[model samples]
Structure formats: structure tokens, C-alpha cells
Target: MDHPASSRAGVIVSAPGRRASLRLSYANAAAWGLGNGLVSSTLVIYLGLELGAKNTALAAALILSAPQFLGLLRFSAPALIDRLADRKTFCVGCYAASALLLLLLPWAAAPGRLATPERSLVAMVAIWSLYHLLEYLGTVTLWSWLADLVPGRIRGAFIGHRERWLLVGTIVGMVATGIGTYLWRSHIENSATWNPGDRWLGYAAYALLGALAMLAATIPLMRMATVTTTASRPADHVRRRLAELLAPLGDARYWHLLLFGCTIAFFNGLTQSIQFLYPAAVLGLSLFAMLTLRSTMRLGQIAISPTMGRLADRFGNRPVMIACQAIVATGPAFYLLATSQAPWFVAGAWLAWIAYAGLNVCLPNLMIKLATPHLRAAYIAAYFAITGLTYGLATVVGGWLVDTFRDERFYAFGTTQIWGIYDLMFFLGWIGRTGSVVLLFMVIEPGAKPLSQLLRGEPQDATK
Candidate 1:
């Protein structure tokens, strides 16, 4: 039996035990990433498009955004974690349950008496939403659990190392799935003996394999040391509990971080659906081709994640975050340049997105660093809730704009043809993203040097 701890502030395990836990954590990240890549947005969008659900922008938007919208459920996680008091059990149970739901996805899209194309699309969205809800809760608990397991001084390096493994797993899974799907489609198209509907069988195979990988991810958690919560009391009053849940709002520095995060999330989501639709619908990119692009992005992430993490540790997360955010904001310009005639321009967009690796590593490190140890879960949950809701709302609104102006076109000087709804949304996304950088300046990270000083290799001030 595992011993119970009073608080989850620092490394609670022995050095040997900590080493073992880190190894298991790396394994968990790998398996989880494999599962994630197998059931990625590329596959979901492809499945929806195959079901004839892309006739409207709203459907595609929901297919991509609805599951993320369920991130609002993260707010419930702190209370649930407190009630359960066993982060590992809550995380493992949620992951296992979510993985099981993947089995239903292929059937949800398969033709049947009860399933029309429209109905199948709705079912797919419903299933994914529930899956994400469970997964999101598990993620909250897992992060809170990890905060105690890893030391703060080397947190950046640890996250970077784990991120590299995660990317490796994702790249392998995506490439394999892409190759499998490509060959399967090729066979169905050429062979007279195969039923075209048999293509759904391929999806079933992917779902089963992905589910197994996700289940495998939980096994590592079972081996790791358990971190028990002591912050909440069983006899605490309802009103007091409510106040505790809302406590993060009283933190001014965390509030600034929240503002920056939400702003960035909204802009990033504003053109989320179009990112997939334009490549597939307008440019006629194949599933394999799209997956290849994603793999390339992951490869870039793998290359830079460790370096970015070290830079964050050396120069502070804020400076690295500011630089990466600026680079990522330019991504939409590449999308704007891509036409059916020159679809390769989209490759630049993916390349520009490689900078997101830095932001991903730094953002969470900062969040974990900022939160009070006991109330860490609540702080994380609040960040996810506000940012996620903003993102979902932006996606839905952007989709509505696309649907509302599907046929409309505009021009700057009435001679040069500005594209339709897509161009407009992409331009707005660029503007929103670029403008949001100002907010990052307001985010206070003590001892964090300015980007200028970091670039100049200046030493940190004695007082910071």
C-alpha cells in the first residue's frame, strides 16, 4: 500500500522513487500521444467530410470545436479531485472510460438503419464531446499530481524531455495511420472484390488500436506514486467550498496570466475550422497529405522543444513566450497566400507553427509556477475554463461568419480580388493574434528578463 501525504508541494518520493516516477511519466506521455495522434482532428474532420457533413461551415466547426468547448468541464475537476482525494484513481478511471468510448466512434459513422449521414455526424460530435470531457478532467488531475512530483528548478527541462517523447510518439502514430489509411483507400478504389463501405472497417481498426494505446497509458499511472490532497475538508460548508473554488480570481498576477491566455486562445480559435477546410475542400489535399503536414509540424516541435525548455529556464518563460507568440502570429499570412494553384504555400503556415513548441512548454511551466501549491488545481482549472470557453465561442462565431458569407467576395481597390469568407476570417485572425501580444507585456513573471536582454546574453540583474 502507498503511504498518504499531507501536502503536494514538492517531491514527496525518495530520489530513486522520483527517478522511477519520471520514467513512468515519460512512458505515459508517449502512449497518450500515440493515442491522441491516431484520433486527431485530421481524422475526425476526414470522417465528418466522408459522412457528407462538411456541406456547412457550422458542422465542421462543431466537429473541431465542440469537444474543446467541453473544456469548461475542467472547472468541476478541483471539487471532484478534492472529493475523491486520490488523483491517480480519478485520472486512471477517467482515461480508461474515455478510451472505451473510442470504440463507438466507427459505429457512429457507419451506415445503418438508424444512422443517416447527418445523424452520424451528430453522433460523432456527441461521442467526441463526452470523450474530451472525461479526458479534460483527467488532464487537470494529472497536472496537479505532476506539480508535486517534479521539482520547480528543473521543471522546464523535465517538460521538454517529456514533450520530445510525446512528439516522437505522435509522429510515429500519425505516419503509420496515414500510410494505413492511404493503402486501404487505394485497395478499395482498385479492387472489384472490396466493398467501398469496408473503408469504415479501417476506421474501426484505427479506433481499436488507438483505444488500446490510451488504455496502455493508464498503466504507467498505476505504477507511479500517488499524491493525496489535504486542502479540502469533508466537513467544510457549501459556501466555503464555493469560495475556495473561486479563490484564484483573488490572485492579481494569475489574473493577468489568465487574460493573456484567453486572448491568445480566442484568436487562435477564430479560424480553426478554416485551417482544415481550406486545405481539404479548396486545395483538394488528400488525407495522407494532410497527415504528412501534421507530422512535419510535430517533427519541428520535437527538434526545438528541449532547447525551448532550457531557454525558458535560463531566461525565464515570459521572454521565450513573447518571442514565440510573435512568430506564431505570422502564421495566417501563409494561409492567406495559399490558393488552389499554389497549395504548397500552406506548408509555410505549418512551418511557422513550429514556434508553438516554445509557447506550449513555457505557458504551462509559468502557470504551475504561479499557482499556490494547495490551490494549484483550482488555478489551472480556472485558466482552462475561461480560455476554453473563449476559444469555443470564437470558433462558433467564425463558423457562422463563414456560413453567412459563403458566396460573398470583397476587394481592396475593386481590381485585385480579395477571396471570400476564408480570407476575411484569416485576416481577422492575424490581426487579433498580433494585437494580443500587448497583453503579454502585462503578465508579471518575477526574475524574468526582457526578450531584448535575453537576446543580448546579458546577465540577470542581482535584484531581478
Candidate 2:
């Protein structure tokens, strides 16, 4: 039996207040984020650079066409999550399969005798694509549970606290990854004591570990599940609210929002694509150094998150998002200005976190608030699908730009021709985001205020 609004909804720890719930959520997020970072940041690089795959091949791998895949998955979600049942079991099953796919990565990385270089690389990409699709579906399903469990009022602070801890774990994981890279430069695995294939093999092990971590965290959540089939009065009003809420998307507000949001999505994706390349190629930094950068930036989020969360709750989600967008949109442009100075790394890393933590804390909260509870999961999925598909389009365009130019980004010394490509992405994305910011002001609804505000922010007589 699922109790939709109980604070204890499937949460393992039997406790009260904001702090305890925050801890429980953080544990869950850390496990999920670590697994995701490993797959997204490293998978493409492991293919193109390590396996020697070419530009177009890499683009296809990057595309993976996940957005379209989820559109079909969306149809089945209602029954599986809301109607048919067994969402938890389904999530566990998906994780198990994903872990299995991960273990194959090391074997695929091995130069094979049966398959040609191209064929082996293609097979590996296919495996990774399948893994991502499964993971994405599982994630959407899992996220639905969180939305059902957490109340609307504290969502911002709740998620912020959760991300703070997760960022800490992410830092640890990133540091470990950097160590693996540094060791790879030598004849040994993560250190001088191992063999050449140790790096990828060890990574496969990390993937398995990630799945196990998710299970560990989820069990705590599931421990709190109801033993009997519980029922609720159907939320008919919620449905009515959704129809009204989504109506704005059909008007000018929708285009304005989509254009701006997609722009932010595109530049963010571009940075993501080039991120692995920068550490290994441009900075002349060892994999370890890159990890250090990732860790340092993420660590900063610990302080930034609480501040950002409360500010969003106190002021508004829009202004906080604008502040974040500025840091992110303008951040990349700083790279071209950076010389061989030591502070360059510090500057870029700060800009990166401003975007990273802000988005993580705000976007999910904003989406949840904007949509009605009945439609929350579906709306969130739709949001993810749009952003992800846009991400695919952006990555493809960037890849083409990189390829058509012969991958020779530099025409002059002290100038980053390729870096300029990345900068233009941010410049345009900022304009796009600014447009969305403008829309938020128009469609802003007072009813979306946090739960804590219910007593103060609402009309007092209505409370009676």
C-alpha cells in the first residue's frame, strides 16, 4: 500500500524533521550520481581515444537517441508506476541488468582478434547505448517515487542538502578516477603494481559497485513501504490543475521557456562533450589532475547549495536560476582569456560549480512546483526527454563542427579556435536562457510557493 503524502513513504530510517530526511535522501543521491558521472563523462572518451574510434563514429555513440527511446517508455510509465504496480521491483531488476552491461566494458576495450577495430568499437557503443536506455528508464521510475514521498514545501532545501552530501561522495569518486588516469600513464594499473588493462577493468568494477550502492540505498527506502495495499481518494483536482497549468506551454510562454531552457541545455551539453578532452588534451593535466579539478569544484557546492536552496525558497526559483545561468553562461568565455596562469583553473572550476550545483538544486524543484502532483512524474519525464533530446542535437552539431574543421581548432598561437566554438555555444545559450527567464516572470504563479509558506504567504481567513 502506497501512502502518497506520508513523510515516511518508503524511507528506511524512522525519524522526523528536516535533518533526518535530508540525510536519507543524500545517501540515495550519492550512489546514483557516482554511477552517472562515470558513465557519462568517461564512456565516450574511452571509445574515441582509447579504442581509436573516429569523429562520426563517436557522434553516433554520443547521440544514442535516448530521448526518442523514452517517448515510447513514457506511455508505459503510467501503468507501471501509478496503475499496474511493482515499481520498486522493476527498478531493482533494471539496475541488475545495467550492472551486467557495465562489466562487459573492459572486455570490449581489449583489442580483439575476431572483430576489426571499427567493429569492436561499434559493438561497445551499442552495449553502452543499451545500458544508458535501461538506466534512464529506471532513473525516471525511481525519481517518481521521490516525488511521491517528499512534500512540496521543503523540496528545495531537501534536495539541496541531499546534493551536498552527494557532491562530497562525487568528489571522492572523481579523485579516485584521477588516480586511475595518472596510473594509466604508466605501465601499471591505478598504481605501479598492476598491468595495462587494469584501468578499464577496474572501472567495470566501479560500475558494479555503483549498482550495489543504489541497491543498498534503495533498500532503506523500501524498508518503509506499506505491507498492505493502501488506497487514496483519487486526486481529480490534481488532474484539473495539470490541464490548466500545462495550457501556458501552448501560448507564447511555452516557446519562450523552451527556447531559453534548450539554449542552456545546449551549452551545458557542449561543455560536457569537451570536458573530458580538456583535462587530457588541452591542460596537459594528467587524469588525476582533472579529477582534482572536478573534486575541488564539487566540494565548493557544499557551501553554495544551502545558500542557493534557501534563497530560491525565500525569494523565488527564477532569480536564483538567473544567477546560476549567469555563472554558467559566462563562465566558458573566461577560458579564452586564460593564459598559462595558475588562477585559470581556479576561475574555470568556480564557474563550473556555479552552474552545476545551481541546476542540480533548482531545476528539479522548479519542475515539481510548476506541475501538479498527479502529473509530476510524467511532466518531469517529459522535461527530461526534451532536454536530453536537445542535448543530443547539440552534441551532434558540435561534433560536426569539430569534424568539418578537420579537428584543427587553432589557427594561431595563444588562440583557441576550438575553444571559440565552445564559447559561441555558451554565448548563444545565455541569450536563450535569458529569454526563458523573461517567460518565468510572465507565467509566475503564486500558488507554487513552498509548503512552509502556506501559513504566512496565503490568505489567513482561507485557512479557517
Best by TM-score: 1
Compute each candidate's TM-score over C-alphas.
0.93, 0.76
- Residue-pair clashes per prediction, in order, are 0, 3
lDDT tens digits by residue: candidate 1, 242-293: 8767888988998899988888888878899888878888898987888899
Q: Per-residue CA lDDT of candidate 2, range 148-227, in tens?
A: 55555656677788778777667666666556545555645446476554445544455445545544545443443322
Flag clash pairs in model 1.
none
Give Cα-based local distance difference scores for all models. 0.81, 0.55
